[model samples]
Target: LQELPVFAALDLGTNNCRLLVAVPTRHGQFRVIDAFSRIVRLGEGLTASGRLGQAAMDRAVEALKICGDKLRARNIRKARLIATEACRTAANGVEFLDRVEREAGLKLEIIDRQTEARLAVSGCGSLVERDTQGVVLFDIGGGSSEIALIDLTGHRSPRLANHIVSWTSLPVGVVSLAERFGGRTVTREIFAAMVEDVAVRLHAFDGRDRLSHVLASPKFHLLGTSGTVTTLAGVHLDLERYDRRRVDGLWMDRDSVDRMVEKLVGWDFQQRVANPCIGADRADLVLAGCAILEAIRAVWPSERLRVADRGLREGILSELMADDGAWRSRGRQ
Candidate 1:
């Protein structure tokens, strides 16, 4: 295993920076050997300023430096680094990235929204069942949310995203939503406003009804990949601490999700921070994320929602390995 080729994937989202280093497996998949994640709040003031703040950029650069050091420590065979919504909309995004390369020795590409949506689907592919008729997969990010309506009514392809019937990336996310509506003290009315804002944007997507037939099928469900859903899953389990092993691929029925959201809505800021699953780092932003999730649920009512902790980074690794034909020798001695 030590001698196997290593691949790296890094995602610098609006709220966090994450890295994944893995080695291809005999079955065409990859096993993570090393990983890193940090909430740098790269888009902390993006909505009001329309530019990344100096303090935010510094935090992100520091995180990227750590990632750069990790990448250099290994015999990396390939790597793909990317920045999402924050960077795409930021006026000084390119400039800030320049500083990153000069200071951290890492170059990141700002991917388009469709690409973001597709990669999210790819990352969460394993969560979908083989017999599933359809899915409305959504990734809620710090700066924007990407939704993919996958119609798997026919024979499924190896890449789940290939079956995408319609996709949309809304210019709304936890950071922006929180900053706008005041996350720390969300009243029912404030929460409702946030939901309506996102719902307006989501409902406008002409493809919102694209998967009506699939939704009518018994196998159809919602697949969510983001910190929001993962947090809800952790709370629902009454976990003493965050555990990816337990939360990832977890299924929460509609009623369970409703109860969890209601539970959070009733708590004060400190109460939210007290919960192990919603620590101080995420307390303020959790409600905003919930608002986004609620809007999605309203548009696409599903009996169940599958939570995925994996997203862009895993998607990048999957695509890179496939492109390099790492799986061609599967099962070979």
Candidate 2:
């Protein structure tokens, strides 16, 4: 295991399948050696069907096969493969995973909402400024959205997730929301309806008052780790092509977010597909994401939001490296 230091984390979510392989670095971080992401729409029609359809299962299995091949090719010391909201909620989720194990030679563990929230916080830990008093971090996923209210009042823990005071996992996400509303032909009215629906769901969360209290302080800001926010950041920058270095950890003010959402709402399906950052694959779904973000913005109304392109996969790698004492052993060596 010591000789082969690579670790892998695979997150098979409702809409995407992603894999990351990394080696531990200084200060409890890791350097990415390889990564893969594919929008397979594994949860398509899942909302209406209640079970994973055969086609969706097939698409997911094909993606997993590629991931399995990569894992086998590497001399990996440890790895954690996880499935999120889709697998957690789908009636045929277990059976589908078993099929994945058989066809793709991968076993995917379905993680719960709380763990999802914590992983997101862990993934974006470095992005949060040390001086910041509090943060409202959110992950808008394909099948669900996880929001965490972090309070760093007394003392900061090595694990940023330790600072999370309250968290909520909304049942609605990009895929589900788009399915609820219409995605491809989104009008201003349709966009408003989407936001209102998510707002209704957000009303049930108990952390609203707590977050509202934290918002009064200037040090508190919103941080988002998801494709939805990342895509918005990309569109806002007017990048010729999507660049992670510039997009990740970038700051967008309330007005900027509002402006971007408005611009997107104005765009037709063809216009969205023409966008370099949001290509044909994401064209239909981006507005649904914006609506989710809008609901979040309405609740907290932060002046600035820090964008995060990192999430569950990064979190998994960090935890695996820490748990294995890879950094401690390296220091000794």
Candidate 3:
């Protein structure tokens, strides 16, 4: 019997390190064979220091070592490992990646913001319904938030990313914003300040107005792919525990989103930590994410928002499989 060919994708973000290993399935989507995720807080002090700190680097390295082991264990036909926001902004970003290569035996490429936006759209492609005309997709990362304006008015492209008309990568993410505004002890005033700050940065984007027009149409809606939005969905569902099957592709209207954010704001740090979904790992940072989400909402004001649990990692897997013709090859076999 022929062994199934595997593909792997690793995403090292400011807040989390995630890996996905999969084999192409019949429906063009890949089936996960193995996966891993951990909050490494690689960008914990990056905003203040402008460099990757020793402690943070150590944490990230340890996570990467585990990912490397997973990759080596599989017969990976193609793999793409990437570092985002944290590595892109830190002064010693490349140096840290060098250490990662040496210590983890995995080469990680620091992709630019454009590629980051593209990959995010690609990852959440399936979430966009075929009838949808225009959509605004955003990924709130640890060190940055990427917002892409996708126009599907004319014809739907095979690659959802092809429909992206404009996109922006905000320097502020959950970690950076939290560090700036004090993630813990967030009052309504503090959260508002964070939202205002992000909104100010967003105002400079030339596409905001054009996207705003697209958003006015009922056919358009907001799509969010990030820990922040997923946590919101989980909290809204009041799930005893986090479940991707329930959270991913879940829809939350504007009022529902507002209620969840308000509920979170009312809770103190300990309460947030106590929540099953927003446990100790995300207790401090979840509000920072909410603030960014608020900023996006202020700009787009889409009535309905869809949650996506997948992003860059799925995008990388899809791209690698397509490039390798893995599905087609499987068909022949």
Candidate 4:
């Protein structure tokens, strides 16, 4: 292949369905050319009912239809679609995937927790610090949070290659959080309560002295790949609208994150909905996401947190393209 063939990856999460189209470049990198995401809240009622709601499924299918159109338009050579927590927990998940494959002309893979953690690390590896002795990566999503502890000294210890020594999937997300606590108008007390709730949950996965371990290392880094961090980046930049270039790979300190949360919490739902960055789609859920971030920060008090706008979709694209060795070789040559 003279030119790298186009590839696609779709991620259907509990709250959002997203698609990305990209082609590998000569520099051993893949650049996304087009992407789409829709908030269908696929896991809207999964928390209470333990099953995906029909309305939610319909909303997801509609988003998939749009994704199908985009994939067809891009003439993608290979594509992979994966559904996360929502599908994994849904009793009718297999039935939904079957319908997606037949109706959307796309096959869906429901990945397990371990695979989810690995893929997230792969997709956001660029954000990892090279000189760090150890790093903790946490992804806060709509239905689950995946935490990975990466040992940067892995090359020194063969056993450390699988350095994700500590990994956990928290059974909470923005949708569930928002639904549990009123997302309409949050006061400072309510926000603190929400953070405390998440913190209590984190007690189950607390790493003994991970903060101290990172504090002792000069190269310690924090990588967060989730809507929460990305949205914070967007708000921090004070963007009139969402811009990935300005949001991705951005850095924010603890104080900055706290300020943003305060600003959003102070805003009524209507005011938040009016903000271009928060918009109608994310206004309600953004506060809940902020609470999750606060909880993570409380546990790991990193001065600087790196944001990763990329996640599972990029991981899938990388995997499919990697499987095609000839295609990768062609890119290298």
User: Best candidate per lDDT, number?
Assistant: 1
Could you give the C-alpha RMSD of every candidate to the true structure, in order shown? 1.2, 1.6, 1.5, 2.7
Clashing pairs in 1: none
Between candidates 1 and 2, the one scoring higher on lDDT is: 1
Q: Which stretch of 10 consecutive residues in model 4 shows the poorest summed lDDT?
A: 153-162
* lDDT (CA) per prediction: 0.94, 0.91, 0.92, 0.80
Give candidate 3's error at residue 82 in angstroms: 0.4
Per-residue lDDT tens digits for candidate 4, residues 1-333, read: 366588998999998899989988653358789999888999987878888889998898889988988887866788888889989988999999898878887788999987888778767755664566777788888988887777666463322225666676777888888888867778888888889988988888755354465555657667889988888788889898889888888988768877887888888889888987888888888899889888877777777788999898877776777677524476454
Output the worst ten-in-a-row residue range by lDDT, candidate 1: 324-333
Residue 299, model 3: Cα distance from true site in angstroms: 0.9
Q: Residue 208 of model 3: what lDDT?
A: 74
Q: Write the per-residue lDDT of candidate 2 for residues 18-90, one digit (tens) a residue.
A: 9999988787688898899999898899899988888888888998999999999998999999999999999
Predicted structure 4, TM vs. truth: 0.90
- Pick by TM-score: which candidate is best? 1
In the predicted model 4, the residue pairs found to clash are none
Error of 2 at 315 (Å): 0.8
Tell me the tens digit of each residue's lDDT in model 3 across 1-333: 778789999999999999999988874587999999999999988899999899999999999999999899877888999999999989999999999999999999999999999999989888999888889999999999999999988877668898999999999999999998998899989988998999999999998766655677778999999999999999999999999999999999999999999999999999999999999999999999998999899888988999999989999988888788887877733
lDDT of 3 at 217: 79
- On lDDT, who's better, 3 or 4? 3
